[model samples]
Target: MKQPNIILIMTDQLRGDCLGYAGHPDVKTPYLDTLASKGVCFDRAYSACPSCIAARAALHTGMEQSHHGRLGYEDNVPWNYANTMAGELSKAGYYTQCVGKMHVHPLRNYLGFHNVDLHDGYLHAARYGSVPYRESQFVADDYFYWLKQELGVTADVTDTGIDCNSYLARPWMHEEKYHPTNWVTDRSLDFLRRRDPNRPFFLMASYLRPHPPFDAPQYYFDLYKDKPLREPFVGSWETEEYLRKDGRIFDSKTGPIDKELARQAMIGYYACITHLDHQIGRLIMALIEQEVYDDSVILFTSDHGEELCDHHMFRKSRPYEGSCHIPFLIAAGKNVLPDLKSSSTCHAVVELRDVMPTLLSIAGAQIPDSVDGSCLLPLTADPSASVRPWLHGEHSYGEFSNHWIVTETDKYIWHSATGQEQYFDLKEDPHELCDRIDDPDRQNRIHELRGHLIDCLKDRTEGMSDGSRLIPGRPYPVTLPHATAR
Candidate 1:
């Protein structure tokens, strides 16, 4: 059997339920929907840590947060892994290359790829006071330098007048071709055209859009400006934290500053996704034109999901479905993996950690014992196959510090800082609106899930649990190994 070329497409902060195939009533993602129709889609995929840095740690290392040591969003921590998915594929004679957003520390660190054309967009930490900024490697900020090259020295993220983390909406200041999403696709197509054909290639086309600054091209933004959008998910028991007047523009933790502006942000967000979808279409066409489409395995997913005003939350790092859930699709071309079912949806609870093993499996490469993720190929072949009974996920975000135990049917969450517990019947309320923690009939289920959470954290350093019960309000650092101490 011949090894297949692999293409991994990742978008940052994209919600899992926003796609047309996922029954989203508003957002349009034709390209992704088409790919999902021909492949296996994991309906319960999630980001273990629900933030860029920590989520990527799981994707890159194939290990859970507890083992990877990135308990939360910490930037500039060195990526010192001895074995990575790309390294394993490269060792097995695959030409590995990455085109965008590695998000590893030291910015230039390629992990184990043969080459990298990096474009990590608008990282405030790396741009301001972080070590990568202070070391005078500002030239290493590839997207910034490239933008300046095209628009001169005055080109800046602020030129769009939108905060990186805020829900403010705007169109790209320049032409559509100059957008980072388009640039990522352009470089990826260039790679497809120039890749070494002798060896099967592993290419990662990572995009840093549909994230924030809500800056899609004007035409793309126009696609949804006047269109109706579904209102954000708001729970009956949810608090009104978004109503607080924080007055901070760039880093406002809450959103829906006004319902009208929030709708505009939704327009921008959906437009960015559609624009990215079009770019993905172009990349696929390039592959077909290069005559490699029939021998390729293409996987598409996001690092984590965006809240988009869900339960008054704007950004990620929460335990809610809107923050943690993400899209996971694996599509093999006609000549590759012909035995797998088409248009199948797997209900197993998978996570970013599963990606490394899946890709390695496709490449016929060895997975190290250090990896905690299981290969998803078995589940793809037999949809009834179960990977694990449940998945444990959490993140540290001030008041939102939370840990969750999720299965195919229900979820139990523990907010460590507030000692608040919430339970939802995922089978009944996939939107997670009705909290059932207080339901008398479900006490036993809640206790069982809480026990699962306790077992998940008993071995960790934060002392999240005693032998038999959970401990709340026990504070832990946002970054393990402590970012401030670093």
Candidate 2:
């Protein structure tokens, strides 16, 4: 019984329904759809947190944000932190490697993994959608510096947002020669081509697109120029959308996002997603070309999802379905094709944290007891795996005390700064239009979710063995690497 290799493909801020397989009307995610047809499609795959750093930390640590405490994109991973799956797998002698946008900290290879390939960094430069005035960087020279040093692919690398008018006038929506996604995939292919297939390996190829700047390559834009973009009836820039930004909206807040501009933006975003899907296709092709596709297992998902104006919110970092519910697809080796690929969907409200343990289990590596996420093997085997009755997520950074709890039917959110509590019955309001928090009939559900939320906080705090952390006023060191500047 030889151990199988694992390839994890992460696309930043991808939504579930945005793919053709997921019933996307206009967006053509053909490769992803094909991948879904061969494996399990977790229709309701959930993220522990919507923010980039906190969500990834929770995912990798198999712990909730409340437990791991690396709350923002800037907090560095603690040196003494629990050994991650990468660390444990490396201990078991797997050839573990990572490429692309590494948003987590302790940026060096502390996961006990071998060969840390820091290809692209995630921060302001990679942020898409509407980059707020405060955090937007028009120049990305730092990213280019590393690209030239390593891949020799060069671009102006300057933050383009500095002169929006001038930047838009440049003709190309994205840098033609060296888009970040292209660069990441380029290096990843290079690494894959020189693979030692005899040994078991874990390869993480992460991409930071469809995440922000809402910028897509010119060709991708051309691919979706005529798509229709419709804003949700329940969303508005004045309220939920504006609030979600936390004052990050760079454009005027006079009214809702223009319908055509919204359409254009959606086209760009979907195009970027398609671009990413093609990259995965290339990697998968590489596997087939190398005759390793049948010998390996490949999983494609995202750290979290992006809210493309679903709640009128421009990006992810919110607990809406558009942001937290990502597409989870797994393609087992060519031999034992998964049964639930087509007619089945995992209803279990799972978290990204489950990834680490699940990968370890499948790889025949020793699963450590430190992670908070359980192995998702059962769910993968059978779509109706008894799902968690209730799930919790949190992200504490820069005055954002975002925490959420979702049960079989109810979704409750707690925002401390505004002293607001929101409740929605997902069963009835799939679009999340009606807020039933004030309804007397839903009081019991609210109370139940609140109790679960408290229990979750307490459990994570106790398990973490650290005092609760305070949200900061500004973004600081996210325990980032030198490649992030690129």
Candidate 3:
């Protein structure tokens, strides 16, 4: 049996319900929908840490947050994992390449990819005062360097007057072809043209869209601007105090209070997604053009999801569906695996950590003992097969820091700071509109879920659990002790 080429398509902050195949009403994702039709969509996939840095650590290392040591979002922490997805694949004789958004520390740390064409979008840490010229994004980022060459040195993505994390948006200041999303695809297509034909390749086309700066091509914005979009889901658990942030703030995590601005933000976000979808379409076509379409295994997912004003939240790092839930699908070419199901849906609980083992499994590589994730290829054939009973996720955001347990049908959240609890019947209220924490009928089930969380935290250094019950008000660190030791 020959090894198959693996293409991992990753998007930053893309919501699980924002795709056409996922039954989203407003977002148009024709290309992604087509891809999903030929793949198995994991309906319950989530990002355990629900932020860029931590989520990516899980993806690369194939370890849960506790093992990878990123409990939350923190930048500049060195990625020192001995075994990574790309590293293992390279060992298995695969030509590993990543095109965009490594999001790792040092800006240029390849994290074991044979080569990386880097572009981590508008990192504030890299652009801060007193930073060395070598570490600056302008010098470290390939796409930014190219943009300068094409449009002059002063040109930048920030020229649109939008903060990278801001919900404020507009079309690209330059032509569509120069957009970062296009550049990722452009470089990926170029890689296909020059890749060694004798060996199976592993390519990660990571896009930094639908995260923020909400800039998309005018055509995509136009597609959603006139459409009647749905309002953000506001749950009964929300309070005025929690939702009191001034939405006028450029990067308000509480989102825009102004309905019009919120609407525009949605337009920009959906447009970015559609624009990204088209770029993905281009790569799919290129795969076919290169005659590898029938021998490739393509998996698409996001690091985390955007809140997009859900529960009055705009950014990630929350334990809500809009923050942790992500789109996951694996489309294998007919020649790649025998009798693999297509146009299927899997209900098993899965996470970003699962990507490493799954891809290595597809490539016939030895699964490292250090990997905590399981192979997902089995679920592609048997959608009902169990991978795990439940998943535990957490983040260390200030005040709103929380731990959560999610299964196929429900979710239980515990805010570590205040010890506030929220439970939702995901099957009944997919939008998480009602909080069922105190409901008499649901307490037993909630207790069981809480026990799962307790077990997950009992052995941790944070003292979040004392073996029996969760301990609130415990000091939380973004990176755990293991990460610090590294």
Candidate 4:
């Protein structure tokens, strides 16, 4: 069998439920729908960690947070531990390239690809702050430079999304402006057209839109104006902290979501997704035009999911399905693998870490045992391919990290800072509308899942660092200011 080339497509802050094929009536993801008709779609794909840097570090490096150590927004992933997909492919005599937002810190540094044109999925306030590279090497932030040169746009421009609206809300809703997703796609297409085809190649195209600033081109925004956006999941305001954030996103009008604002935000998100879909379509066409489509495996996913006001939250930072779930579809070389569901959804709980091994497996490459996730090739080919029943997600909020484990029967979440515990019977209450932690009727099931979660933590987490207050699987930096001296 000829080794298949890989082209991975990643969109920032996209959700598993947003695509039209995923039962989202309003969002028009035609290309994705067509691809799904011929490929496999993992309906319950989840992030290992909900935050961008940490989650993506795990995905790219094929290691847990403790192993790679990118635990927060600004934290860096250790590039020395092992080979990433790019590194592995490069060693196997394939030319690997990256051309979009990969939140793994040091831009092209931790990324082991041969060719890199890096960008962040969203505008990082840290871009102008500190980094290993000089200004010229900061490609994601170059949007500002490019926008100024091309559109003469400035930072002082007041976005209509935030400024003044009574019926509508969300800080950046009215502020229409140039966004990073659009630019990432443009640059990626440029790379695709100009790519050298001498060596079988692997290129990652990452998008930054639908993540924040909720900005989009006028045509995209207009395209989704009348689409029926998915409604907020029930019990969205159950958590006091969540309620507080909701107030802030709507009150000050600097950031947040209201009912209508959230609706329009969905349209903006759909617009960005449609924009991304078009770019993806163009890339697929480029691959066909270049005649590389026959021997290549195309994988589409995202770092994690956007809250999209799913649970009265504007962004992802929790263990809920909305925050952790994502869209993962793979087309195995000119449609070798027959479509399993014809726009189907897999119920298996898959972690982002699994992506590395699966991609390597399909490429006929060996994945190091040190990497934790199992190869998902079998699952893709046969819908009955089984994986872990539980998908765990961990995240740090303001220096505090919370751990959660989701199983087929129940869900368990634990916040280390306050020792807050939450339990939900997912089989019964799919939306997590009620907390069943204290429900004695299901205490036995909760305890069983709790033990399972502890076992999972034991198996995946490395060990506790008494000084850092972190367990094995999750890691935190000692100097993040929130880290007080012992």
Candidate 5:
């Protein structure tokens, strides 16, 4: 059998439930909905360390947080993984290319792609005055450099005065063709036109939207701006500590206090998603036009989800579903795997780590010994199959740092800084509106999940847990000692 082409479509800060197929009432993702209809959607996919850098580390290296050594969000750290997904596939004779958002240190570190057309959208660290000219986005990022060339040196992503992390949003200031989202697709289509046709190709078309600077083209904003959207999920468990920062604070991680502002934010966010969905449609069309659509295996997912005012929170790096749960689906070309299931949903717990092993399995390539993730292809054939009983996830956010355990039906969260605990029966309360942490009826289940978290942390250098119980208030570092050594 010929090796099938692999296409990975990645979006930043996209929620698992924000697509039309996911039954989201407000968001309209016809293209993604069609893809999900022709694929198996992993209903319970999550990011163990729900932040861009950490979740991406897991995806690239096929290892969980502890193994990959990135536990939370931190910039400027070197990515030194020895066996990356692209690198391993390259070794297996695939011509790999990534068109957007590597998000790794030194800006141009390709990890393992044969070539990279980099654009890690508006990274503040790379734009710092202390950063060398060679490493700064002006020279290091392909999209930024091209934007300047097309519009002159003074043009910048910040020209609209919207901070990258701000909840405020508006339409793009430049031509729609020059938008970073379009630039990624434009280059990706160019790659298909110029790729080595004899070898099976691995193309990662990553987009940086539905994240921030929520500047989708005006048409997308018009799609949902006046529509009645669902209000943010504000849980009963929310406390003053979590809601203290009002939404007016530009980049407030908490409340928008103003309901109208929240609605506008949603408009911008959903608009970006629909715009991204159309771009994905373009890529699929290109594949068919290139006559390789039936010989490609495509996977779609995100590094992490935006909080989007869920529980009064607005960014990622949390243990909550709004931040951790992410969309995951795999659609294999009919010619490549005719028996693969379509229009199915899997309840089994999965994560970014599983992407590597799954794709490698599809490509008939060797999955490295260091990979801790399982191939999910088998689950597509049987949606009820079990990959694992439960998943453990964590993130190191200052006072809100947390560890969590999630199964298909429920979730348990523990705040490391304050020793606060919250539990939710996800089956009954999918939005996580009510906290069952103190409910006597659910104590046994919560205790079991807590034990899972303790076991996960017992061997850590920070001593976050003993074999028996969790020990809170331990110093948390973004990259563990093992990663630093690398």
Candidate 6:
């Protein structure tokens, strides 16, 4: 069996339904659509812990959120896991390299990558003196440093006057070539020229766009500036829309009150997706030029999804579909066609943790027993193969802290602080605009789901549930002792 080269391309805060292949009404992602047509698309993929740090813990370690020990976003925590995706691949004689946003603690813990040309774009936690001076966070990121070296020290993301964590939209301050998206693509393609060809390579091209600041290059912004965007999903129980009537535009977690500003923000966000798609096209062409296009296995996904004002929520760390659901596709090149599926859709619930084992299986490497994710190869061979009966997801976002369990046909969510419950019939109400918890017809279904949720958490140290019932008003800590304390 030929050892296949692997390319894992990840985007930050990209929603699952925003892609053209996903039937999005306005977003133009032609390159991604083409890739999906030639690959297997996991239509119901999710992030277990819908935050940058915690979601990545599941991705790198191939463990569930409970086992990985990060239940929410916590900065400056060390990433000292014994086994990692890159480390295992490297041990199997693969050259591992990473480019762009790795939200790992200590700023520059290589995790398992042999070489990392990092470009973590505009991390507010690392920029505000939160990390010590000895750490890499105190210094400028590689992309920012390179931008300054090319255009002088005055060059910065602040030049656009857009806040990194806001709904404010703008074009890049400089040329499109200097944009971080292009930088990631550029450095990633450069690796193709520098990699040791004697060994199979594992390259991670991680792009930090479609997240916030909504900064796309001017040409990309123009692509969606005049298009009509689909409105965000609003539930009957949602109250934040009218409550957030006014606030500072740059730093507001609540999106703009004005309809026009919200529309523009959507335009900027779509532009960023299309811009990223074009760079992906460039990457594909480079792979062809290097003559490795037909011998590689390429997977594309996002860490988590953005709310974009859905239910009046703007950022991540929520249990909603717009925050936890993400896009996942696996495209096998021509040389590996016999071992992988093409132009197929898998209905099973897949998550970030599955990527490590799937790639390891493709590489003919050993999969550790501690991995919580199952190899997706069986599903590729038989789309109806059973993977998981249900997927559980949660995150801590102050009062919005929630835990949820999703099956193929329905979803159940519980708010830890308020003891509130929401049930959605996914098959009938995919948008989740109508909460069905209080529906008299669903009392039995709700009871069954609650029992499942309790069973899942009954053994945990958080004391979320006893064997008989759920314990309300008790929220689990964001970071467990196994995560960073111990």
- lDDT for each candidate structure: 0.86, 0.64, 0.93, 0.65, 0.90, 0.86
What ranking of all candidate models by lDDT puts the best one first?
3, 5, 1, 6, 4, 2
2 or 6, which is superior by TM-score? Answer: 6
Stretches of model 4 off by over 4 angstroms after superposition: 76-79, 121-125, 128-145, 152-179, 226-228, 236-246, 249-257, 335-344, 456-486
Lowest summed lDDT across 10 adjacent residues in model 2 is found at 162-171
| Model 1 vs. true fold: TM | 0.96
Please give, for residues 275-317, the per-residue lDDT of candidate 3 as tens digits.
9999999999999988999999999999999999888888899
TM-score of 3: 0.98
Per-residue error (Å), model 1, residue 473: 1.9
- Candidate 4 lDDT, tens digit per residue, 415-466? 6555667898777887678888888898887666666656645643334333
Task: List where candidate 1 sits over 4 angstroms from the true fold.
Answer: 130-137, 245-251, 482-486
Per-residue lDDT tens digits for candidate 5, residues 370-428, read 99999998998888897999999999888879999999999999999999999999999
What TM-score fits each model? Answer: 0.96, 0.82, 0.98, 0.83, 0.98, 0.97
- Better TM-score candidate (1, 3): 3
Tell me the lDDT of candidate 4.
0.65
Q: Which is superior by TM-score, 4 or 5?
A: 5
Residue 57 lDDT (model 4): 65
Report clashes for each candidate as comma-separated counts. Answer: 0, 23, 0, 15, 2, 0
Model 6: residues with Cα > 4 Å off, grouped in runs: 136-140, 245-251, 337-339
Best candidate, lDDT: 3
User: Which sections of candidate 3 miss by over 4 Å?
Assistant: 484-486
- Could you tell me the TM-score of candidate 6? 0.97
Model 6, position 287: C-alpha lDDT score:
88
Tens digits of per-residue lDDT for model 6, 151-261: 996788767888777788989988889989999999999999888887899999999988877899899888888776788788897886343664347446566777777
Residues 446-474, model 1: lDDT tens digits: 99999999888888788878878888888
